[model samples]
Target: MSELRTLYPVIEPYETGWLDVGDGHSIYYERVGTPGGTPAVFLHGGPGAGISENHRRQFDPARYDLTLFDQRGCGRSTPHAGLEANTTWHLVADIERLREKFGHEQWLVFGGSWGSTLALAYAETHPKRVSALILRGIYTVTRAEIDWYYRFGVSEMFPDKWERFLAPLKTPAERADPVRAYRALLTGTDETARLEAAKAWTIWEGETITLLPNPELTAPYHDGHYALAFARVENHYFYHDAWMEDGQLLRDAHKLAGIPGVIVHGRYDMPCPAKYAWALHKAWPDADFHLIEGAGHAYTEPGILDQLIRATDRFAG
Candidate 1:
């Protein structure tokens, strides 16, 4: 039997600071590992979800010059949860700005979920700047993918949760388009309605994100601030389709042809079906693909984490 691959030891960043990216956005960034090492940047999931120190542990402290940053309106970045000028294009530009700020010619890009979407966009726009990619829970932010999770597809598997997710919508029209309905409440002026809608939206996600149900994670959604930002940002991006043309990422796969990369996906991932990963592999056959048999959407799942660690170890050079 193969031994389980674990994350490198917990390591603290030697440097941490904010990068002023203009437009009233100052991104929070940290550098871990040796001062001079293989350059790698961790692109966190959630077009709005931010980074944590645990993200820094994904790389070898001695071999990788790991950098992690909270994108606009996320984590420790200023103007918390501010969405102005925070489109996908802005994010791609931010990645480049970070690279230029750090003076690295090229660096490995590691991302998951929405991060995968941004990674693809960044690599396509600035191919020469990305040496490789390590994507997990692959999401292209296409209309079909968004519709699958939010509209009708995953509902079949979790009818109860879906019903609870829809409880906030009173009218048939609102129920007909949950995405738009939730978006209205999230962006509405009524703070109570917004927080209520945010809780309902977040609870539905927590319930379905994993193969086995864990209701406890939904507890965090009670914090109106966290719930508001997470739900609002996610809904905003999904509503706009991450501001990309239909099937744009798959159409742009040619740009990643020579870039060595790995796609780590859970076989039973509900938030993002495995077929998306399969489609990505078909488009970019050069990239290594691994399907963890007993995992779900979380990158920290045992099997998924092991595979991610292995991929990073392989690319540590």
Candidate 2:
């Protein structure tokens, strides 16, 4: 076995600003690492979970120029948690706009979890613009995948946590379709109901993302403000099935044909099952795949992060 890889170091963005992607959406973006180096973009998961400072350290700062941004309604993006004009496709276009803004003909794209879903969508839609891809905790957002996390599968694995997740919905019918139930509460005019639903939804994910209980990791999910956007936007995306046809991403895997890629997944991941990542590997046989043992969904998990850092390092050259 070789030594595990870790994040490079804490580095601040040399440039940062907001881009008005229209539709009342202005996404916050930042640039870090070497200027005019090998270009790359980082996509944060959650559909609602925005970028973090740690994300900037995933690549070799001296060798790659990386861009990280908040999606339509999350993070520092304006209209925080606003669901209008925010969908998988809207995010895809925002990525292209960012690439053009940076004047990069092509660049590496790195995403984890929901980020992986978006990366696949963007690469498939515009294959020629992607130089490489590094995906972790692959989540295709298929109906089965959605139900697994929100409805049934993970519910079995974390029964205690599942109960807390279920507490927000008081009835059997609402419980039967948690996504729909949560969406109603998240979008409802009652501020108290919205906040209650938000915390429940966000905390469920935070608690289950790791193999063991990680209070540090799960703490932020409790924040009323962050949870509101994280839950609302995330639930909104899942409720609509990300506006994607069933298994659409896997159906279009061939679009990644010539692009260099790496797929890293945790064997114990709960939010995203390893099976979908396996399916993606089979579909795009050209990409290297690693089923990391003893880890869960988060990119911070040691084994998953090791492979991710290695992929970025290898692609930097």
Candidate 3:
């Protein structure tokens, strides 16, 4: 555990580049760690968000070549929230583009939360191209999962926060369909009303992230861009039902079984509990399952660090 005592993982020089997938779409990505090292890619969560710098630290620079990227309409990617050519299919295309851009025979795919959904979708559609998967906090992104997130499960636990989130829905029709609830937030004509909606949306999301976010996160809520991008793409995903259904990944886990996989989940993760990983394991018994005992949905959970390191090390091996 001597490797664990550190403020930040050692970051080697990293490169940021933009890949054009044509049709006026480009993806922002960062390449780091050793040259010609085993290829390891990082996938960020948030269907409509930027990849955080801290997330890139989980991989060991001494061990593997690391790649981190913002999905279309996110992070350093251009036309943020334009949404003209952004979808799960577009994202899967971006993954393939990266594989060809880097000239890798196959690359390791690492993702968390919503990213896990994208990785699963990508691997399922392009099974022959993937080398391995390092997935954390499995989220299949089914309608059941989205309904649980927006309507029933987590909200039932955090009623007050849910009330605050639903406060903007002045009309019964709006409350009945979250799509209307989101339209009021994202497309409201009044700037003040837009800010109000952004506040509620951010609050609800922050609440899900291990209770209300700390002091640091609240400031971003005041800025419309974060909330706008978040509201835009999240609604896109929720409206489209996250593009996957029950047992979908399971139906094709065999294609990836020949490739390695490591699934890490927190037993206490309320947002997406460990049960999802257990289900995936039921399909691909060979996939490694690392259940974090005391951790919740938050990524800073110590078990996440350990399991992530183990996955990276496994790739090194």
**Top-down TM-score ranking:** 2, 1, 3
Model 2 lDDT per residue over 66-113, tens place: 999999899999899999999999999999999999999999999999
lDDT by residue (tens digit), candidate 3, 1-317: 45542224656446888988876877889888886888877888777767776776777677678788888877778787656777888888888888888888778888888888888888878877777888888888766777777777877888897888888878877877765577656665787787677667765775566432555644555467777677677777767766556557666777666767888888867668566778887787767888878776656666766777777777774
Model number with the top lDDT? 2
Q: Sort every candidate by lDDT, greatest first.
A: 2, 1, 3
lDDT of 1 by residue, 281-306 (tens): 99998799999898989877888889
Give candidate 1's root-mean-square deviation (CA, Å): 1.5
Query: Superposing all C-alpha atoms, what RMSD in Å does each candidate have to the true structure?
Result: 1.5, 0.7, 2.5
Taken over the whole model, the C-alpha lDDT of each candidate is 0.86, 0.94, 0.75
Candidate 3 deviant stretches above 4 angstroms: 1-13, 188-191, 211-222, 245-247
lDDT of 1 at 9: 83
Give lDDT: candidate 1, residue 260.
92
- Per-model TM-score, in order, reads 0.96, 0.99, 0.90
Residue 1 accuracy (lDDT) in model 3: 44
Which portions of model 2 show Cα errors greater than 4 Å?
none
Q: Which should have the higher TM-score, number 2 or number 3?
A: 2
